[model samples]
Target: MTFDRKDKDNVTLLNFYLQLLYPRMVEEKMLILLRQGRIGKWFSGIGQEAIAVGSTMAMKSEEYILPMHRNLGVFTSRNVPLTRLMAQWQGKLSGFTKGRDRSFHFGTQEHKIIGMISHLGPQMALADGIALGDLIASKEKATLVFTGEGATSEGDFHEAINVAAVWNLPVIFLIENNGYGLSTPVNEQYKCKNLVDRAIGYGIEGLQVDGNNILAVYDLIDSVATRMRENPRPVLIECLTFRMRGHEEASGTKYVPHELLEEWAKKDPILNFEQYLLEQDILTPDAVAEIKANLKMEIEQEVEAAFNEPEPLAKEEEELKDMYFPYTSDPVSPEGPVKELRYLDAISDGLRIAMQKHTNLVLMGQDIAEYGGAFKITEGFVQEFGKARVRNTPICESAIVGAGLGLSINGFKAVVEMQFADFVSCGFNQIVNNLAKTHYRWGEKADVVVRMPTGAGTGAGPFHSQSNEAWFTKTPGLKVVYPAFPADAKGLLLAAIEDPNPVMYFEHKYLYRSLTGPVPEGFYTMEIGKANVLRQGQQLCIITYGLGVHWALDYLDENPDISATLVDLRSLQPWDKETVSAAVKNTGRALILHEDTLSCGFGAELAAWISEHCFKYLDAPVMRCASSDTAIPMNKALEDGFLAKSRLKHTLNQLLAY
Candidate 1:
């Protein structure tokens, strides 16, 4: 419904009350359920209901809102079915996340709500991405993201706001400053006088309002949203409110002062709004009582119905479903002549081809636009696709990664480039928790590719040079691809972009310019999870990927008499188990090699799998050749010693002899 300041008819007033009171009643009932051990937990938005209700009511239905756990009014204001919402809270199959998540933790696309992650700050960046999508589509839409004052202290908050301000995206950073983060007081949270003051640092419009006053919040947000749709820029709004209840019912308010509680109680948002309505002759005492009574009854019935609903059943096959969108590869055979390209050029060519093929594809990274990225992979991307598609982002890895996820949510294929593979550690949370789990938790496809320029050998030092693919290989729902040659680099990159799942494409820095091979002129894709056998033999099987593939090739080239099978496991996560097992069984010896540390490396998984599946055919124990458990040193001599190529050749010889 349209919010009008001058036209506050009885019907409008009553609807607003319903919007405000419904959540109040629902929260009260939820608390009761929590006390009765009916539901798992409740994050009560006891006194600060107006911020959610007012903000949600002010926005257009087409616009999006990312609400925190405490903003239950946003859900009620959007008119989400109470039965289904309660079912969600009860961990039933009818819930939005299919019982994969609880509370307001899951987002409903139909309601235009993007769910907030437990890591509260990342949603801010996600909001930036959604806004970016809207802006790109030329849709006059704005996105509102809610965060507490405590969450603003996170690096994601700064990164998201900075990115939003720089891009001038239509995003409203709503800070529900409810006095405390769990038990910590606001005085200790930040040194600034007001949360709104920090907005000036980002050069964005900042405002503060009496959050407990429903009318004031509604009027301000309504006006702000109207302006944002037209102007399309970031704004930071700090809602001054209080949390009357504990962080959760179980976390008691013993740490909160009795005096403070009394003070906030006097400023209860619902009571104050009711008083305002009464003075305006809009809602009488009886009317208020009647509205609350009806809402309470409605909430009770819905909660009861939800409680009676069947809980999510655990089936082995069902549990494994929806981790990723079904992907089928249609192999493209080159009809024309192929040309030789460097690994870096091949990746660049693949990116260009994908961008040309998919109009909705976007590339984001630090210095990717004008500076051509740290490694110059995207040197001419900005010129080719313009800044909108090939956007340069701040050095905030976490936020940009989250923004990529947000873009994917809005039907955009996003490819985020980490300047170096080691730098992925900064964006680790977004990759592993948000991107990796988005599909499994809520059946949302995270069609994003994170390009990681990896490996050591250039004396790039510990941080820049790392074979950290194992970190994500172990994480469920993430596809890790490490291509050894230039052709595989291009083909796998295109394949990764096309996959409807988050794919980590690892590019070895040493192979970028040093490796050259024939790549098809036109677009082509290599199958992920499938291994390519470079050589065929019968005495021994060598399973490896990335730099190890080259090492094994060189070793085999020198020792031609030693009959061996060299298998290039192009994909680590869904490694070519079929090919590796067959090769191992045929050869009767298995040797795994990698650039990562020997202990707990991806090779270890291969070794264990080979031992388990190929045990009967094994002529000797499965051997592994990898780096020692130490950081890659900057000194060339030290790095060479760390890689231990001599050890790799010796290990292969030992396995073949056995």
Candidate 2:
């Protein structure tokens, strides 16, 4: 590789020199910290500093930057203070995340930079959402996202890139092809001639650059930045570089040939940049030495100060505040007699009322724009809210949810609709791993709601009709809510919009029109994590939610002889344990029911809890009734038999007989 001899002024030359020195100084100090047992682990960007520094330097100050763990140069270039970085690595309270997470896993609203999670591929998809939100607002800004060659193998990588392409989001996908994914070589990870070539299929521009040449990398990105800002198009730029160090401190490169490592070390990004500056007479030899010495001193002082700071104390009560949804109530409620409304109409009214009240609320889903969603729940929403707020996304479930997460982090609450509740499996990675873990991992707020159209009655078959609430209930860091009435449905949807955490709001498809009742006309919020007692009784307790709530109510109404207290467990995760336990202890018997499958369902957890806590109070074994352990068939007869009302009636009769 050769350098282009051109003077782009003193400011540019000076910044290039500093970028080269910053990462080199930090990585060397990181090795010392590891030896002293001050930091736990380190992933050095040693030979690839140029790619991080060069690409980021081209971005505007306000443009969002999403970087993976290895991009140390990008962090420093973005003006992330050395003290905060040092404190974070040392696990001190003065760190960015207040010691919630260790190293590079922290973000701040002020900097407009989202700290990278361990999942490298998903961040690319998230960047698309952030960029999409900006595009919707007509903001002239671009998003810069970084990943490695190995991450391209992940499903999220393709999903995000495809969405960006289809939507023409102003996002720059920078792939740092560092030759290897930990111990595995590039050949084993991808079969393409070059990673950038894959952009041909995405209908985006592609380019490959010599990542070791800082000047060339900067020039290529700088030329495209202005164009991307104007047109807002997704572009792929592949930087060919190598990680001179092992994956982490302890992970030795035994799999890499010694000759290969030696060859790459000779072309180190920082060392090459330094030589270029010297040969071009941009700086004298003494000036180069002085810059390195000053950077080292600054880094050492930062480490010393950060190590002296006190570590953050974890208060159980205070920390628990961030664990679940904070307590809040609705201000707008009906003063006069409430009007009767259909359950589906109530949901639409709730969305309209919330959108009118809160400016930060936005809705995204497939066919949600002109089509108003699959069931017309959002009919005419586009005309009322405009295309910007009411977005029709591509058929990418993972991208839809992942982008919603990005919007949440950026101070906007996203109401994401899964076309079918069962289709959420396509974006399972974002739902369970990313959305559920963001708050717990770094104490960052994920204020987003995933609206699931769940349950069966329309004979939509296995793929469309499924009660997947059990899947989310089993995962931590999520609030699951299922409303059986129009009033609760409207109130809870409003409450979820105002929540500061992620919520899984399951709207049963069957109850959308069949179950109608008097609903408040104005904005109101039902308290989350509480159960509603529909009917009080002394014979037994029926713990149910969603469609099961209706079944339990219908059975008791018809069989007037059996008297039982029906508890609607609206909140499945942090369920109203106090209410259910008290009701069960009073009745001396319990029957847990749900629309989900019988085996390994959420009801199993409830049954176990009742047995453990209300054990002595039990008059008979705590029984659980749910849909048969089979896929919901397309035939109405088969589906009804699968979750038959008669079967539920028989289960209640048997429990009453016991």
Candidate 3:
């Protein structure tokens, strides 16, 4: 029979093709629910199913994966119930993670489908981390980080792969090279002849496989997996496949010339595989028909099941609400080994201690290994812990972030560095979509920290300086912290490292060396969300955080007559409204201050909240003193003017005016 003999093994090519085709068709069918009037938009991995399915099949159930958005074929082939997949596509309750998971970003730890991060290339670091974990846990499992050729252009690709290669992490960095990253073709995007060739840059093995050959794909992955079990090194395999449809449902191939589409269409993987099977006499014509029929029915049934299942309970939406809420602390002091040092010293010490205890704790970033980080924050880390733990990364922000994500998912506690806070935009997806949303997706854990040098006091100008806390403050399931003093800095940072979610630890560059404080020797735990009253007053509640908290402290000290209650809301995500309300009620006047621009800043959210709940007790309208709505200035005079320089005397005069 032509259908049955397609493989040397029991599997048939016809059956494999159906495994690819039917599930995709069904997933697209579900998308029609929200897309009014049958708008046919899909990132169809149609031409690349053989590779997706074969690689998926070859992977052990225990092995994990970091899939990108277009790998729907692989997801369906893995037996993910169609209904849940549909729920995801439709943004309904029935979707993965109760619809908290974005469309095409589905994950299940049970299924070893670790995640599908929304951003283009951030998953690389997460996969590296998970691989680290697997090694630490001594689990006989490997991780796969799947991306596109376009994604490799992201800094994350280089960072993640380099670290994985250097650390000998058991991860396979697979690039689903579908020729184009959106409208831009691979040829136009880079000078590299092939993505597979990039592995040499990381000093790892690289290969190119025929993505249309399911058996070849399976064999290649199986070989890689086996090699990983022993070598524990990262490798890259570029599957030279073509995407049948546009990048996403929203995109049409209008941008792609018709000739190119038609030419590529002639080489559809399913058709090619089918012809190969027919030539080999692997599957008979009659048998192929039966398999297709069965696959179609199975896909339809899964869709029906997904549609019939009750949507994730809308009334119980509160269950998914903890994305930003901080956990309460234990009454007893968290007992970890304590150390006495300066605040930055404590941060450095914590890293030293943690890495000393856990060999798997890897610290990577720009100039972190030898040059002691751009901040010199990681000074002597490499000398103390060696290159494995303190790694100097390339100048690729996306690559470094993606590598950190991979390391974390691989079971390494990665402290990723972005040379400056202004550069965080380069690694934004790693912080937001992937690392932040990972825990909710796997329903497991991804404990990692992303540290950046933030704020602007030096003459670094507009480009080199920024405090983008407000940018990340709006993202759920992420904790953003800025410390006013050294003790809080060390304690809170340690807390973030142990936390199961991703954290953005912003350390102000101005205060790093200037605002030194004696941190007690040994380990001490600081509760994350609980706001502390630095100075108690009855006249007005000066609600502030981060660099502003330090300014407020100095202001309050100078103007004791104002009788201001200074509250530092340490953790911005699970922000302390209760603390703010109590302070406002006690003082009857509230002022919100921050270093960010005035327009839609974090303070704006706090002010609106006060207007809703604490407005009745306001003795004065909430006053805000923040940077004017403009980019930070390059000139010293304009720069000073643009910033919200504190004047307690000026603010008090206003309250008196009211």
Number of the top TM-score candidate = 1
Who is ahead in lDDT, 1 or 3? 1
Model 2: per-residue Cα lDDT at residue 308: 87
| lDDT (CA) per prediction | 0.89, 0.86, 0.73
Query: Sort by lDDT, best first: what order?
Result: 1, 2, 3
lDDT of 2 by residue, 1-658 (tens): 6777475876778788797789878999999888988788998888888888888888887888888888888888888888888888777777876677776787766667777777778888889878977887788889989989999998888989998998899999999999889989999999999999999999999999999888889888887778998989999999998888888979978888999999998888777777777787888899988988888898889888888898788798866666654546544555556988888999999999888987778899999989999989999999998887888988889988999988887667899999899999998888888788787666677788999999988898999998888889988888888988999999889888888788999999988888789997787788888899988899999999998988888788888888799999988877999999998999998998888889989999999999999999999889888898999999998989888454887787788889
| Best first by TM-score, ranked | 1, 2, 3
Backbone N/Cα/C clashes per model: 0, 0, 61
**Better-scoring candidate (TM-score), 1 or 3:** 1
lDDT of 2: 0.86
User: Model 3: per-residue lDDT, tens digit, 285-359?
Assistant: 887788777767776677666666665655546655545334444422445444445555656766665666667
Q: What lDDT tens digits, residue by residue, belong to model 1 across residues 1-658?
A: 1233466777887677778888888887877778788777888999999899999999998889999999988988898999999888778899888888888778888898988888889989999889999999889988999999999999999999999999999999999999999999999999999999999999999999988877788888888889999999999999999888989888989999999999999898877767777777888888777877887788788878888988778886866667777778776765577999999999999999999999999999989999998889999889889999999888899989999999998889999999999999999999999999888777888999999999998998899999999999999889999999998999999999989899999999999999999988888888999999999998888899999999989988888898989999999978888999899889999888899999999988999988888899999999999998998899998999899475887897787667
TM-score for each candidate, following the candidate numbering: 0.98, 0.94, 0.84
Model 2 residue pairs with clashes? none
